[model samples]
Target: METEKKFEPRIVAMLCNWCSYAGADLAGVSRLQYPPNIRVIRVMCSGTVSPHHIVHAFQRGADGVLIAGCHIGDCHYIRGNYMTIKRAKFMEGLLNFAGYSPERLRLEWISAAEGVKFAEVVREFTEKIRTLGPAPSFEASPRLATAVL
Candidate 1:
């Protein structure tokens, strides 16, 4: 018997309410073509998304995480995206040091009017993650297992 493999990557998307979330909703309403792998969580601002959320997603078996926010100087909160960018950069290094692919965590700027761009971004990011294969974050380390036991 041939075993069928699931090709869809599990994507966790943290979208800023003022921009990226609206963009994603527009993508759906406009019937834009894209992968269905992305599961979006709307936040008041991207700055609300912490490294802990990304780490938790990884531990729960998400293959990729995308954080979408407003463009620089366009933040609804006057500087929330700046914090988002800095925090995401720091998290990238931390995740990489912890043996995870930093590429799996992406930060992007998507405006509410850019539905097509949102769809395209999702498609592109999903494909890149597929090529990178599944993340090993779900696999318990020896020390972690010992602690559990």
Candidate 2:
């Protein structure tokens, strides 16, 4: 009998440099164990991650996308995380309207000191994505294209 290969979900993580990225770095330095399913993109601020970027990641076959930044009232750039919160909501709605599962997108706040939290978040999200299996749109329409610009 042939053995079936396990499916591993691909995740795109957009992390804010001032906080979430630092937290991820801390997680690494702490030698925390987590699934190696995510490809992280470090941005100056989570607020700077545009909807276009998120959608583009999905278009490129990402099974899940994580947007992490500083906690509320703790943005390095005052009011930046506020914008992140607002945009995340809008993006969730837009993605849902586009026939994608909103659950595939997650928004979280991870402070620079929260290394364990970072690892936990990644582990939880990875498991969630694994349970959801591959993204429906990516599987149904492998050649779907959109102009992100």
Candidate 3:
């Protein structure tokens, strides 16, 4: 009997440079253990992560997308995280309307000093993505469908 291969989800993480990115760097320097599934893209602010970027990641085979920024009232650019929060909600609703599972997208606020929290967030989100499996867009791509057939 053959054992089934486990599915490993690919996660795209967009981290704000001021806080989330620094937190992730700290996590790395601290040697904190977290899932190795994330591919991080550091942005100046989470507010800069547009809906197009999120859709593009899904189209390009990312199983999930995570947007992380500084905590409320602590943004390097005043009110940047507020914009992030609003955008994330709009994106989630839009994705759901477009036949995608909104759960595949996540948003978090991590301060520069929260290395452990960064690791824990990555671990938890990775597990959630694993449970959700691949993004529907990936599975439904015409190229992938033809190849599978």
The sequence of per-residue lDDT tens digits that candidate 3 reaches over residues 21-138 is 9999999999999999999999999999988899899999999999999999999999988888998999999988978899999999999999999999999999998888867754
Instruction: Judging by TM-score against the true structure, name the best candidate.
Output: 1
Q: What is the C-alpha RMSD of each candidate to the true structure, in Å?
A: 2.9, 4.6, 3.5
lDDT computed for candidate 1: 0.93
Residues 70-148, candidate 2: write the lDDT tens digits.
9998999998989889988998898889788999999999999999999999999999999999887554443454533
Q: Over 4 Å off in model 1, which ranges?
A: 143-149
Question: In candidate 2, which residue ranges exceed 4 Å CA deviation?
Answer: 138-149
TM-score for each prediction?
0.91, 0.90, 0.89
Q: Give lDDT per model, in order.
A: 0.93, 0.93, 0.93
Which is superior by TM-score, 2 or 3?
2
RMSD of 3: 3.5
Model 1: pairs clashing at backbone N, Cα or C within 3 Å: none
RMSD of 1: 2.9
Candidate 2 C-alpha error for residue 33, in Å: 0.5
Cα lDDT for residue 27, candidate 2: 99
